[model samples]
Target: MREELLISRRGFMLAGGAALAAAARAGGGPAAGGVPNVVLCMTDDQGWGDVSYNGLKAIRTPALDAMAAAGLRFNRFYAGAPLCSPTRGSVLTGRHPNRYGCFMPGSPIRAQEMTIAQALRRAGYRTGHFGKWHLNGVSGPGKPIAADDPLSPGKMGFDEWLSVSNYFDTDWTFSRKGELEKHVGDGSDVIVAEALKFIAAAVREGRPFLAVIWFGSPHSPHKPLPEDQKAAGGSAYYGELVAVDRAMGRLRSELRALGVADNTLVWFNSDNGATPAGSNGPLRGHKATLWEGGIRVPGIIEWPAGIRKPATTDVPACTSDIYPTVLELAKVTVPNQITPLDGLSLVPLIEGRMERRAAPIAFWHNPARAGGQLNTATGHAALCDNRYKLHRLPDGNWQLYDLVEDISEKRDLAAEKPEIVQQMKTELLRWIDSVAASYRGEDYRRAGIPFAPATRPAGPATAPAARPRRQQRQQARRRRQ
Candidate 1:
């Protein structure tokens, strides 16, 4: 890929809107009109390359393609974690899932953390959640959630909800505001249709809305409509995606029809990486790993009134940023936000004032390893520092990749760049310590606390060699005391 093509979109936004970008830096207006109506749409297991805009020719995603063409496409967007539940936690709270003990797909989010929905509701925005909601500590097939379920969406700040426990397909049953309702038809389409009804009500009431439409298509049990499957030439996975695209098309169109398209900030992305039957394009690794493919997925933001122009960016972003970004956009602050949030607002980026991410993104899988001290001998952990990616392996070794040159990560640059490895490793380990502290509720209710690096004696900050990395880190903590 040409370097120019990879970055031309960002170039256009930066160059064309220099004044707007400058004004934004001056705390100028995405607030000029009032904050936008927000819509968050996420798909289950959609790959980074699933959409035609990213280069899938087998199945056409006209709706998604249109949205991509008319919005800010994220060339390097990522899921907060490789699994669904954890990434969902990050999106709602703007913190790493491990900070609240949401390690795997069925892990529950802690009650102490503040969610975007809750904050938006406090801001007077109508809040609703539709489709698969797995953060309620439930497993197995998708089922109706009881209103009394402590972890239901109603309990988490959404005023209204039509959701289930996990993945759902056509003819699915949903719990609408905690009432068991069996909905017939394509599940993707069904959820969007329900969301539109909510959106229409909000529009009629002259209120802004935060409608979260998390789709259950393309995950498994590919039961796409016959016409959609036929359109994909008999590929069930692609067919499911085809339906997802159609659902999004209708969503955008309906927003336009309601005369709210320009002011509605619509975000489209995926819960995690692609499944085996799907593709992640050139990215390596699959769902449940720390590689680009596992965490990276299709992402786009379309707010016609707020965006200076349609563009794309290579800057690395993830689901964790959603909470802070939306909050900042609405100018709402969480008074009791869990401390040490892993994300920052993307309003600057949206306004074209951000050329690069301000901080590196840290990703770790299997929080059980993060119990007392980080156990590196199991699961995966990696950090993305702009163009460079670092993985601290289970065997207590480091692997590095210059993503700009090698997106597939076929080569390790750790041997050649020892200094960079040492510096990033120090920061990564320090971050791990902070996360562990949060896990133990050390930072609970201490909203807005900044992430601080461990003030270790310089030479001892990074994990030592000889002993396993995890064990040595525990030993270092004991020695410090």
Candidate 2:
């Protein structure tokens, strides 16, 4: 549990201006293939400060830094959760990982939830996933996914996938649609190459594509290529990053050579916070905490046909925003779509019409999921409502911070801002209940898992609104009387 803290500080950020502000909520602009191609790229354990554009001097990230300079960069980007599997699930589902019982690494994504890949593929977009796929409930060293594995990407919506169980280093093995294949090269380079082939085929076929490239590098075992390791002054972590940057450069080059660069939107970010070998910049905490460092990651979106100039926004965003954003951009509306998505479309944000993020990003991690009950009171939960962050401690107490003034989370403003705390707390509780409902199979329509309409307004799941405690108490007393 946590308690009240105080805060009062001021911070300055960059001003932004861009061209081509579109009014269309869907189909951002005309693309080469009628709809823009999507390339979603994510790295493992890389931090917010891991990029040169973020003021990092430890390693070179020219490719990623260039992307930030050419497109829209997010100053306050977050992973859905502080770990790999949970955040990955957020990207695919546009919902909090807890909503689908994907609370931690190696957690199996429930079959009932619809994925972005599934929604897009149904709309005739070729979908493919490459590299790390820990959502199948497998762990240990990266291994080729099994054909019979019900949770494989093939079963989860992707038409083709060259994936592994978890993180893979150099010269690793993968399941190319369940067929074993070995690759020799830097891990990042290897996956990007595979993804490029997928993209090329989609382009030749004149089909818009959704390529989910999850790179398994700089996570653990610190295995970098000999040349890359030497180039990094013998630090394997930085070495892995070198290969990552080069691989990204190659991907972009191939996109241009294929004449799809202008319309292809490449969204780049990390799964979670940095390890000890990486940097979270000035933020506090690491890897698994609810702090800014653990959840905040480097986010960049490069859409040449849409975003014409380099711009940056301090508006807070999360990985959950990916699914809805992609779907809207592609104009792919799912039939009987799942309601109350935790993500909001960032199309406006990319078009420069968005001044502030509309909804708060809810990060939920309740790992007591394998047979054990979800202990929201003792598990982790946090709400990033614009400039403020409210963390629910394991002991069921609360801690609030003004992230604008205190980026390091040094101040706790819960005591000073009781009204704000109460309001955000109400929203958090409402959101938690919604996630719990989804966890109980209420959102799933099936024989065993009955589809039940939501009885109450899940206010906090989309927008931040408060029903006062005093009024609630009065209503309760009247009901009792």
Candidate 3:
């Protein structure tokens, strides 16, 4: 009799309001077991201590500070790679960028790999992508990518997008669903405004949505609005960040005004560490290095309906976890058995049930070879467990640090604990071997998959001078074009 009554109630709901029916079909609304909307906001080169909440004294980020106070913040969060494109790929696939040939910036993500957007779209979610889209290999500064570009967000399952192939500044042109559109304002504000339009429409239709907003501020050639530049006390770099902070504030307040703030999951972080203009706290090294300063980034997630209490955790997490966590929340599964994923879902941690990470995080940065090309002798690699982290430099020298005791990685403990060093070395090598196998195309069912060799464009190089001639040429050509 109870089962019959429950069935009758469900039938009544299905036959009631059109909004309720749409919500039920979209896995939203109270009767359908409320599916939360998702918003992922990532900055270009902001670092671990770039925000005021993390003790940054140079600039103020009241919006982000407020988010840290009202949400779950991550003290030891990391980017998937030390660079932009690779880390973005990991965020979409929950796999290392090398697994799919996105080794560094300007490298395009392979179309064969399944993406989070694709999975969510199958689950009845409206997907939109905004702001920087460096995953496509249109390498100059920023430009509107061709509509038919294989790596565009449309091909990655995003239903709508207003994006640039790379970073943008003030008064930049954006590709709106593959068509060029001009916007006048701060770049960060422009993207957030477009994303809000999509979100508002989804809410009006009672549909769950996934909005990915990638900011192109605080990056090289920093160009902040005049007002923001003045607000930053005349520092162009800090001025760019001021624009980003203001945009973030607008995004949060607009969501609340739309009445979806409580049910929306807004996750914010940086793609990697800082540039020369930013700070990575006390850690050593910066972008392009496999050190704590390169990968460690500020991370926060606000989901009032799910995470009832605001909190912070030091448990290690990375951008790669985004894909799996979203899948877990949407209750979706991949249609095919893909390669082994390096990221684990963070749902357990979000629910306060997890005390430790299930697996250690691994990072490899080798720009000399293409993604998935195994050249252990040519690049830097690091493996970090809960306490100990081992770094293998290009010269084959190994350095070990206990992160808990040395958050800044100032002290090397390799000589003091040889046993732990050997143990970690063995584990790290084993993992590297697996990654090498995947790099050899062993993970793909078909062979001869083409990889676009890194190209050099004709222009003054913005990257390090040590970069190979091929990459320099690629950058030069991109500039000339």
Candidate 4:
């Protein structure tokens, strides 16, 4: 029965892909209407209050503030997960990271997943990834990936790339199309410099391009240039962010100089919430938890051709939405149903038709080792709509918050609204079950694609376990302290 079910699903996917291809041929893709160039820029470990425009008094992000003033700004944008790798995977696949077994940082995305770059390239766009590429597992910072590494950006459908395995600092060594190359100056400046080269070449040839620039600054071991450091008022972390802000100013200016700024779609956000050096605004918790502070970050989109007037929306959005949103805007179709997508296209929202999100967003994070194997019985999960949020902790305790009324999550309303809590909990559990099924290899058994095991080997099965309620309460108390 299981084998038969897999075959049936695969058949449906193939038929779907064929239909999409037929539609593309009938419409001639985005070229018929002139596709706008796409540029996706994400910072590492920056926070909701990191940008000067978002009310960060200490750090000045003039470039970001200007972009927000000139384009569509998102007031409630979120990362797919609380960590780096999982959120990055969501940006590419339009699906929750747990669906593909990318449960934590350093976990490798499975080879079978189809990425946004692959889909865009199929639609006649030159795809390039510059800066950090942490979807592939790396041992440490500044290490080179082997040419044969299955998870390299090239294999993931990038035509050209200058990337690092993890966070890199100034004068760091990076892999350029699989060759090690040393670069000087700040890491953010270096990556953007390389990306501009690729973009310039694409423009010279008159080709629409999709450039993914993932910055490595402000993550950890904060190192900033002398001038930027001095400007940061003695804080190395804040200094690093200053350099990122300067880099953004340079990128936007270069886009105008190249005459593509009008037609280019520049979208900016962070991979996760703030580090200790940064602030999450009025929200609770930090980078590793499911609190608003950990997952919510700054989001902005600038496209002079599409958005004539600047505006800001409070409709909740996430990194997973990037893939579907780009595809819809470019008129590109996914050749197949790669997996169950957790994101919805924000075209309607961008056009000012959507007042609220039709679908809720979910996040999951299981406590796992660096090798990606689940270690404890502990995990974190949450579900959110426009107003309310439901959080499920490892000890089977539930907490509910009205995000609109209390963004800080200082009040818990689980007891006051049991009916709403039960309804949300039911839905959250059902989604969790589906994700578990996908994690067990049910989603990859298409007719032609072989199933690949997760990067971390599973340990022997253990009976379901939960910490005692008393101990759980103590841990929660400690967290509060």
Candidate 5:
């Protein structure tokens, strides 16, 4: 795509209004009204019960708890996948992580995929991304940056980005434009501060904005800000989360103070379920699994002007819903060239009218190995159609779960429920074939690399070096898996 294809900030909003009208017409909904500003706050690796509202006794997340009480909490909300990059990718693309070639952590989102930012940009929204941006750079066991990777937030549609290549703690480097600037402060707080600035500017300009504030908190290398550490008493991990919570409080206060809180559809969620340090409440699996604990996440949607009930809904929603949800709320239209969104909008649920969720949610992970980490692995896929779930792993592993009754997934009913499993497996395989055919591989780091000046490989002498590269990738995949 050419840079000229980019919709200007002003034109994007006008287009969004048009797009909303179109979507409304297509959905047979009432005519669209003024678009709502969107604020999507995602915490890294935050657990379901980490917040007090979710029944955590230790962590003090007053702001999040209050937000939950003030809005609609999704009792069965889930991330698009079990890992960060994949879930984040789903948020942007309105599709399964596998479709966008982001099936694992540190993988790049396909440059060809249409991102939520890009879609919203077409509708005239001022977009900005803050915090972790792991969809760029080299994926192997090296620390060097890939200068030409086309998967950064900028390429994905955000006009302004103050982000890191991946998760960072206190006192991190900010990738501004093409250069890096050292910034002092807790990573979570810094990201929120930047987001606040973007929100402030959008408000001043009288334009609808989509500000994605992704906190790099509570992830690994758990270093908490001093004040937050103190607040957590003795646990530094809890301290990092405390910092994120406090910063979130500041963000909400600022939004309300600026009079945008009522108009802004503020959505808070995590990329996936918790890590070992955190709790997934009653859920089963953690991080990289097909179990509920790996995908189920705490989610809240706060819009004072719209959702007046402040209710809880058992309606199953996934991270994929974010892209279309924001687009629908903002009155943004999906361009003709853009692929159809795999996610259904949750506007009806938000409006408190939708009774039962009908569509199935699907998940798949196919990790690729490179150097020393579990770069990636291959897994089939799974889908939740209403109450039943069917999983088809690459190793021919298949299982079925009755999510409503057995959210833990401790027992597999596939043997007894052979008919349902086969039906769902057929559906899953069809999707897999379609998606895999176009998946050329997510080596975004190698995208713009020059072809070694067409230099011939040093034949026999280089054979041993090639073997080591393969071996290193194998080892990395093992560690990650």
Candidate 6:
């Protein structure tokens, strides 16, 4: 039997319904789940400790805090990658970004890979992606691509999209299914309000919906809207965070008002760890490093009808888990031909049936080496077996940490735990071989392939500076040629 429920806008009153109603009225949107909806909300560069509930003193995140209280808080949750596009790629494909050729930020995920949106669409769900869609272009410092690129959210699978080419802020221009729509307001609010419209319409149509709400905030060039700043007491960054909190509160209230809060599964997290502008509490390292602070993110899963006790679980989890979990929840099946997924469903964990993952997890981040619009480099690899984590850097310097004992990864026990490190190293290498093998056709042979070379420190110049006479001669030679 198809389950159905009606959310009385009146119930929102108990949870500050007036404020929610006012917000809803001012924004003018549809109701919540007349159909099943999935809201996957991500904050760019937001730290794990940015929420007041996470020990952040300067910011207020009542809505996110409330969600944590009423939902499942994953203490060991991690982003799929330590950077934006890579992690976002993981969310879309349910596989490591490297597997699909998304090595770094601007790397494009092969359109062939079956995405979360594509999967949900196959299940008769109206799919939409609102906010940041960083998966389409090269990200590091460089030139921008033509706005006419075909592989955007519209090309990815979302039936509707309002997104920026990159992390945009303040009065930004978003492509609405290819046409541009200029929004004026806090970036966070603008994105959420746009998403609620899709949610409302899907509800009235009695159709299932998947709304991937990826926010562009707290990333860089920190600029908060006036109201958000006022709410956060003049701290521009705090204001950005406050805007997200209000957005969350509005989303939750809408879900309840539409009467689908119980059935809907709302997942909240960050693309990676916090940036330097953000605080990660006890975790060490910042956004780009391999440390916990760089990858470990604040993750919450809420399904009122599904999850029992407002609970907490320390089982290590990753964003890769999102695809599989949502697929299982929606009872959608992937074709046998679509390469097997890297993630396992976390339904068992969410339902309190399991305390730990049944299998070990692996991670990697290989810096890009391709040149021209693509000259980039940032490589990393990691593997986890139970509580032990092994990190393989491109520099050939490997480290191991017992996450159970060293959440911050402050101590490197690789030297002391040689036997375990060797075992993990073997596993990590074997997995890398497997992933690399998949990338290269089986029986494909190559020689002198260098992987994980030792990194040299920058001290004295290795080569003398180019002489002006030599440079002039080179230019003259080029002209003659």
Worst 10 residues of 5 by lDDT: 454-463
Candidate 1 backbone collisions, by pair: none
Poorest 10 consecutive residues of model 3 by lDDT?
Answer: 1-10
Error of 4 at 410 (Å): 0.6
Give the best candidate by TM-score.
3
Evaluate residue 394 in candidate 2 and report its C-alpha lDDT on the 0 to 100 scale. 77
Identify the runs in model 2 with alpha carbons over 4 angstroms from their true place: 1-33, 367-373, 446-481
Q: Candidate 3 at 243: error in angstroms?
A: 1.2
lDDT of 2: 0.80
**Candidate 6 off by > 4 Å:** 1-36, 138-148, 367-378, 441-481
Model 6, position 291: C-alpha lDDT score: 79
Q: Which of the two candidates, 3 or 5, achieves a greater lDDT against the reference?
A: 3
- Between candidates 4 and 5, name the one with more favorable lDDT: 4
TM-score of each: 0.85, 0.86, 0.87, 0.86, 0.80, 0.81
Candidate 5: tens digits of C-alpha lDDT, residues 1-481 = 1121222323433443344334333332111247888888898898887888778877678988888899999888889888888888888888776654566777666566678889887777889988877665334221212223356677678888877666778776556544455566687777776677677666656667889888877888689877778888877888998988888887787676566777788899999888888889888878888778888898999888888888998888989999888887877776443443567899999998887886878777764533322222356467887688787766777889898898778789999999998888778766665455334332222343222211112222111222366467779999999
Residues 327-372 of candidate 4: C-alpha lDDT, one tens digit per residue:
9999988766677889999999888799999999998887444342
Least lDDT summed over 10 consecutive residues: which range in candidate 2? 11-20
TM-score quality measure for candidate 3: 0.87
- 57: Cα error in model 1, Å: 1.5
Off by over 4 Å in 4: 1-33, 367-378, 446-448, 454-481
As a TM-score, model 2 comes out at 0.86
Q: What C-alpha RMSD separates each model from the true structure?
A: 14.0, 15.0, 10.2, 12.8, 10.1, 10.7
User: What C-alpha lDDT, on a 0 to 100 scale, does residue 445 get in candidate 3?
Assistant: 52
